[model samples]
Each structure stands twice: as structure tokens, then as C-alpha cells.
Target: MYGINSLIKSGSLEAAYPLHSGTYKWTVSGPLSDRQIYYKICLKITNYEMPRTEMEFDSSYIYKCYILDCINHFGSLMFFGFIMGRALDHPGVVISNPVSEAFYRNCAGLSCTFEMAVLQLTIWFVRSCFKMFTKLIIPYLNVKKRQKQHDSKFPNQKLRQWESDYLLNKSERYRIAHEYLDTVAEYGYVTFFISSFPLAPLCGFLTNIMHLRIDAYKSITLYRRPNAKKVPKLICFTKLLQATTYFGILTNAAMIAFNSDLVPKEIYRMYYNASLEGISHQQFSKIPTSTVYSFYKYKANEETCYYNQIRDDNQNKTLLYWWILAIRFAVLLGIEHIVFLVQGFVAYMIPDVPYSVQEQIAHQKKIQSDRRETEFSFNINRKKSVRETERFVLIK
Candidate 1:
């Protein structure tokens, strides 16, 4: 079984599983026997195996695939956030003043995030629609072709009716190993660059909600019944999420310190006792530029420009520049430490397993032990009784 699973994973084999019956009519008509119903209920309760019926199998497969896709979508979202931040950092779009630059970047980040959310949702929706079209139309074309062939082969005989399940297109299979890769990537994006765009969480939430419904619909109605398999606990996915979250904290801290004017504004407020608005207008010096011929073949007069950076007459960085740089680093370090400490404290306070669940598990163990003892005692008594009967027979 292990080898076959490995082979399936490697694509050497298509699939190896108990085939489901090709229809769900039995569920409505009533199962063949009580045992069949019992098995169906057990399959539903345990979720250890999928039902050997087309509708149940397809439903289960669709659900599992939808979960996997959602994970992938979230990971992609996170990655998109990270990429947006880095991509928007080009010099062409950035302003000269620190405060203005931060404001501009924030606005741009928000717009991009919203746009990306929309784009992601649109793509998923369009893909689903296309799949649904193919699912409904392709099978129909195949049925027509089959009918044509039958008519030519047996002109006098009546055509046989085909089951709907037999006429539907086969479901497309996906790789389980690569299922969570997109999710990991999106998670990294969302957490790592969350400071850049605060609306990311909301955008992610909306996307997931819409995506869930779309996926469910596609799985149940558009795709053919797929071979269902049991999914084990996703330890790797959990660990990846944890890793991304921790790393995101650090990235957010860095973004807050370096990408925004928060640290500089705070430092100025502490040392100079000046307001951010006043500093924006009065603190920076402007450099005048000479009139020059434009590259586009037009002469232009250049005006004075204001910059957030401080430089001397010789174009060297001033003492204030170094000071602000040092302070930024300090702020970054402090933010990370503070956030990490809070995270650790919270984690410690909240245990992984709830107390109620732990008590229930203990209770279950006790019941099992009691049942074992009762069985053991009953077996011993039965053996003694048999020995006594044999002795009585010999005496007689």
C-alpha cells in the first residue's frame, strides 16, 4: 500500500483505491441492507475512509481539494503583499521628503493590495466558470459522438441510454505534496508586509470567503467524482504557518522603522520638541537647479527641490543623518523585542490543549482500561467453568 501510494505520488501510477459505485440514487432509494447503511454512517463519522459511492466520493474529494486550494490562496496573498512592497520601492515613485514619502508609499500600498485582492478573486472565479463550461459541454459532445458511432454500427437497433455519471468528464487530479506551497508563500506575504498595508487582513478575509463558495460549487457540480483518500494531520503546514508568523513580526518591525516616518517623527518630537507638520514645512533645505535642455528635445527651467535627507556643502551626510540612522536601528530592535515578548507571554498563558479536552481524553482512557479488565475476568471464569464440567463428566 505504501509503495502504491508512493507510486501514485510520483505519477508512476494514476490511482489505487476502492472504487465508488457510479451513482448516489441508492442513498434516496434506501441502502441494499442494514449493513450498507451502517458502513455509510461509519464512513461519515470516522472520516477514515471515503464512501464507495460517486456522489459521496466526489463531495469528499471536492471538499479536500477546496481546503488545499484555500491554503494555497492565502500563501499567495502573503507573498503578493511582500512583493508589492519591494516592487513599489523604485526611485521613480518615491517622494523626496521623508514624511511625504511614507504617506505616498502607504497610499500606493493600500491601492495595490486592494487591486491584488480583486485580481485574485477574479482569476479564481473565471477559472471556475471555464471549468464548469468544459465539464458540462465536453461530456455532451462525447455523448453525441458516441451516439453517432452507435447509429452507424447498429442502424436497426435502438440506442441505449447512458447514465449521467458515465457521461460526465473525469475530475482533474492535483498533487498533494505541492498543495500547501502556495499557502506558505501567501502567509509569508501577509504577515511579512502587513505593516505596509493594514487593510491586508480584511482583503484576505473577503477573498477567502468568496473563494470558499466558488470552490465548493466547482467541486460538487462542475468536476467529476474523484478518488477520495484520507488526509493526515498537516504538521508541515502548521510549522510553516508558525515560521511565517514569527518572521513576519520581524519584517513588520523593520518596515515600521525603515519604510515609514514613525521612528523619525518620534525622535524629532523627543529631541526638538517640534510637530511633524511644522518640521515638514521648516526643517528641510531646498537645492536650486540650473536650467538645462530636456532629453525630450525641449528646454526647461529647473526649480529648487526639497529633500528629507540632510547633507553638507560638500554633499557629505551630516551628523543628523547618522544619528537618525542609528536611532532607526534601535527602534527596529526595540519593536521586535517588545512584540516577541508579548507573543511569548501569550503563548505561555494559553496552553495548546484545552483543559476540557485533556479531561475528556483521560476519561476515555479510564473507560478503555475498565472494559479490558472486565473482558479479562470474564475469559478466566469461562475457562474455569469448562474445566469443572470436564471433571464432572470424568467422575460420572
Candidate 2:
């Protein structure tokens, strides 16, 4: 009954986390004593008469949160790009400036800004990679645990679908990690080669650095992810690996801060969750406790129950890691456009700095200097002739 309860509770937590964050109540199938429910209730009970040690929110949920973030950040930035492009050609903004030079200069600035944005995008990519790698480790651990449990149940062995799925998910993660590495290389190389555009040359270098930073995170995943199932030890030595990765990320962040000039502030916000830090623990505690209470309360009624006893497509749909890469690209593009808009507005507010415009401005300055020098010489010659004539008259 406890094992059944645990299964039901796990399923309930999985279902609820993606949906809501607050108080919810439901009923269970079995006729259980209030004592059982008292033992089972894992959620926060503001009413002290019904005491419950709130189960900590699963840290694992962070994987999903990160994925959603990746989606929102990049997807919005992509739309912003289209707006910036359209705004550049608008009659009001286009007509006010020296048309051709202004156009090229603005476009060039846009290119530079984008090159800087790659750093933020790269950090996101790495974070996703780390998350996926951890997922793979988890499934592998699950498979092992399942294997030990299975041998006791049946002497003759046939592998189950869950085992197969775990293996498949594991293989997929490895393949995806390699793909990310390949992409990092490709983007890095191409960014290095392009030099004709204003910011093209910096693109390759910045991208390479981004890839290296992300790749470094794999070490952390290898350490932390392997131990997801092992929570008993006083200090999981494996966690030290995660700590190392954290340090690596901090180091990378610092390097980007000082060494790389291409990072944009908006893009950086996407990587770290400012609102999450304080709220994270409270958020983490609710899921498991809530799951135990809710699943037990609703187990008997199939119509009301959100999860099935057996794994099905609905039960197994938390594959956000698979789609994370595409989502990040979309979000990064949106962030880029927003940054560009802010920058353009700020530049418009401040007085234009000297020689920041096109080469034509420098040429015009040179012509004006030449004209003034020529006029000064002509005036000096006229005064000299008048003085010479006056001397000649006095002598006569």
C-alpha cells in the first residue's frame, strides 16, 4: 500500500507542477482512515489542526522552468528583430537622416549588437545541454533500480517498455549533446571567418568562447546528474562535481564580463532567474507533498484522476529537453531585437559623438578646413599690397 501510494504520489506531482502552484484538494478511491490521510498530507496546511510537513519541491522541476525560460527569451527576441528591420525603413525615421550613410551605419551597429548577443544565447544553450545530460543520467539510474526490482518478481526475464524508453532517452541525450558540440564548432568557425560586416569578425570569436563555456558545463552535469537518485549521503561527492561546474560557469560569466565586449545586458537576464532564488525553495517543497495528498485522495475514481496506473503518452510527456534547442534560438532572436531598440533610443537621446558617423563626415570636415586656410592666405596678400602702395606714395 505504501509502494502504491508512492507511485500514485509521484505521478500526481508530475502532473501538477506544469499546471498550478497553489492550494488544491481532491478525494481518493479507497476508504482510508483519517489517520492515513493525516500521515499522507504533504502540502502546506495553514490550518494548524491539520498539520502537514510540506514536502520540498523537487529540484528536478528546475529543468522544465529553464526550458520555458529559454523559449520565452528567444522567441520574443526573434519577433523584435522583424520590428527593428521595419522601423529602420519607416518614412519618419529614414527621411530625417543622411539616407544612405545613416542606413549603412545603423545596419552596421545592428550587426555589432547581434554579435554581442551570442554570448547570452550560448549560455542558454549550455544550460539546456546540462539539463539534458542530467535527464539522461536519471533515466539510466531509473533503469538500474527497476532492473534490481524486476529480478525478484520474475525468474525468467523480458525487458519492459519503461526500460526501453529509458535506454532510448539516454541514447537520444548523448546524440543531442554531440550535436550541440558540433553546432558550437560550426558557429564558432563561421563567426571567425566573416570580416566584411562591421561586427562580423567578432562573431566567430565570441561564439567560440560561448561554446567553450557551455561545453565546460557538461562536467557539472556528469557530476550532479548521476546522483539525482542518491539523496542519502551526508555529502554526495558527485555534488562536488556540480559545484565545480558552478564555479566554471561563474568563471565563464566573469570572463564574459571583462574579456568579451559583445555580451548584452538583456541577454544576460535570461540565464539567471532573479525572481527564483528566494522563492525557489518554497516552490520546490510543494510538489511531492501535494502529490502524496492529491493522488491518494483521488486514486479510486478514474474520471477524476489525472494520471494512470500505467505509463502512457500522457503520463510521459515531459520531454521539453528535446525541444529546448530550437526554443532557445527563437528566444535569443527576440532578446536581440529588444536590446537593439533600447540602444537606438539611448543613442538618439545623447548628443552624437564625433566621427561616429560614416566616412563622408570626415571627408566634409577636411574640405571645410582646406577652404578656411585658402581664404586666410588670400586676405593676407591683399593687406600686403595695400601697405606696399602706401610706402611708395610717401617716398614720391
Candidate 3:
């Protein structure tokens, strides 16, 4: 990909007339004619049948092209999970990066502060830009490569003429769209962002502008007009979100534990410094609740603390970190139990057959069993008779 597009493309530049042909389309077209003229040429010779209207791909049982759509729907679930794992398992560019200097840098190695939030947001913004550029450029390059290969095989042809007709009975209008890919990618991005940076959803307000506009530009240019289907909700992506809610909890805990200094130094040392001062949970709970402190030198007039002074055993100021873990575990178990209970209740609520119908069903099953047994016996006797007749004829 040509790395960055610092140069702007605006309609106002049309009258410059620097090597400009007097054609309006040229002025309106891109510096790269791949989208305008080349694409139009490709469309002209494309091997598709003429239809004024669009049609759906065959959904009949015979060919079952709809099955491909169904498979893709489910495949997005695993794809999201894979993206989540890869993203979170690595050292993040923001909070996870180790700091070499203490006072030398503006922000700490780890803290849920505005500095860290900004850093995380900036990283996601850069990533969004890179992803946008790649999505726009790579497909066109791939298509161009394929077009060349087609030209080699069938000398005056393009992809339009590469095939006689659509792969399915309908227009190949059912081509894959950016929406499905973007949806799944967004699922992973959101989960990872929430898990890593709580302020990520807020940060999305900025990055989405770049993402939406870039996607709109590509849709208008690089890609073919796809047969539009109205998808109400992405079922697999919704289920993935349900799974990642729990996953986000784990990642958040990990980030707090491994990377951040949210826990007090004494408590942290007890856990990680391998101090022989073996501490018990009872001692931890009794270790008098401390005042939550803020290292931030500046605060607004409406400064308020997130958590109240803890008077209970489980309400340690760090949201009693252990209590949070325990509560999450309990909630997970409760959800599973509720789901099972609901399933059982639904099964019970299903209508039962009338006594007469039940009796009729049982009687029909019995008749079928008897008929099968009779058929088996007849088959054995018939085979024996045929064998005996064949032996007699051979002897004769």
C-alpha cells in the first residue's frame, strides 16, 4: 500500500488545468483511475447476464447456497474469539509497556489515569488508520492481480468475461460485504478495548469518525455494488459479546494485577515480592480500611471518590479486589444455574398430548414393531426356499 495520503482530493482543484484533459469525468475521477475508468471497462465486458432487477441466490434445498451464508454466520464466532485471544495475550502498547524512568516520564508505568487513557486512545486511533488503509488498498491490488491472470488465460477478457454467468442461478450480487468483516472486527476491538482500557468506548467516539469516513470512501470507489441483504442482528457476534463479558472481567483483573499499581505497595509486595510474612484472608480483612488516595495534583471543585469508606469485611477500598473476584465467580455460577433452571421450566411447560393421542401413538409404535418382526421372518423363510430350489435345479 502507498503508506499515507497527506494530499487532499477536493472538487475545487478541477480548474487548475495542469495537464488536465478538458473532460469533467477526469477532473471528478481519482488520481488512480483504477476505480473509475478501469472498473467501467471491466464492467462492460463482464460475463454477467443482463437483469434490470436484483435477485437472491438460490436458497432451495437442491443446491443449498444459503448453507454457505449460515456457515459464515457461525464462523464469525470463532473468528472473534481468535482475534480477542491474539490481541489480549500480547504486551499492549499503552499500559503494558514497561517504563524505564519514574519521574522522567509524564505518566506512570501503569495507572487508570487520564494520561494512560489518552495513550490507549491514541494507539487505537493509529491502528484504526492502518486497518482502514489496508482494507481500502489490498483488495483492489488482489483484484488487479486476478484480472491479469484471467487476461493471460483468455486473451481479451476481464473478470466480467472470466465466467459465463454467476456461480449461482442468480446475480453474483450476493458477494461478501465489508459489513460482516467490520462487525466481527469491531466485536473483538470493543472487548479488548474494554478489557484493557475502560475509557475505550469513549475513545471510540474519535476513531469511529476516521473509520466511518474511510469505509464510506472505499465503498463508493474500490468495491463493487453488492446485493444488499437486511440483517437484523449478527447472531454469532451477539453470542460472542456474551462470552466476552466474562472474558473482559478476567482481562481487567489480569491488567490490574500484573500491570497496574492499583493495589497498595504493602499488599502488592505480600503477593509478588515473595515475602515470607505469610498473610491470611482474616488478617487482610481486619487490616483496618485505609483512605483512598489520589496522586493527581489537580482536581475539579466537584471532586468525589468512587467508593465509600468500607465498614464491612469484604468492602476493602480496592473494591476489595478479592471480593470482586469472588463476586464475579458467584455471578457466573448463578447465571449458569438460572439458565439450566429456565430450560427445565420451559420443558415442563410444553403441552402434553391428550390421553387418547398418547395411547394411539403407543399402539401405532407397537404395530410398526410387529410388522417389522413379521417382515424379517418372511425374509428368512423366502431366502431358504430360494436356496433349496436353486440346489434342486443344479442337481437336475
Residue-level lDDT tens digits of model 3 in 254-328 = 444433333334453565454523322212222121232222332322232221112244442444555544554
Q: Using lDDT, give the best candidate's number.
A: 1
| Candidate 3 runs further than 4 Å off | 1-126, 138-178, 193-199, 229-235, 257-396
Ranking by lDDT: 1, 3, 2
In candidate 2, how many Å is residue 11 off? 57
Encode model 1's per-residue lDDT on 265-329: one tens digit a residue: 77778877565445543234334433211112212223533333455544356788788889889
lDDT for each candidate structure: 0.51, 0.36, 0.41
Instruction: Please give the TM-score that candidate 2 achieves against the real structure.
Output: 0.20
Cα lDDT tens digits for candidate 2, 167-281: 3323322233234433433333233212212343354466557556654553433222332333454222233333333333332333233222233223323555533333222
lDDT: the better of candidates 1 and 3: 1
TM-score per candidate, chains pooled: 0.54, 0.20, 0.31
Note the residue pairs that clash in candidate 3: 46-160, 47-160
Ranking 2 against 3 by lDDT, winner:
3
Candidate 1: list runs displaced more than 4 Å.
1-163, 166-169, 172-189, 276-278, 281-304, 373-396
TM-score of 3: 0.31
Clash totals, every prediction: 10, 24, 2
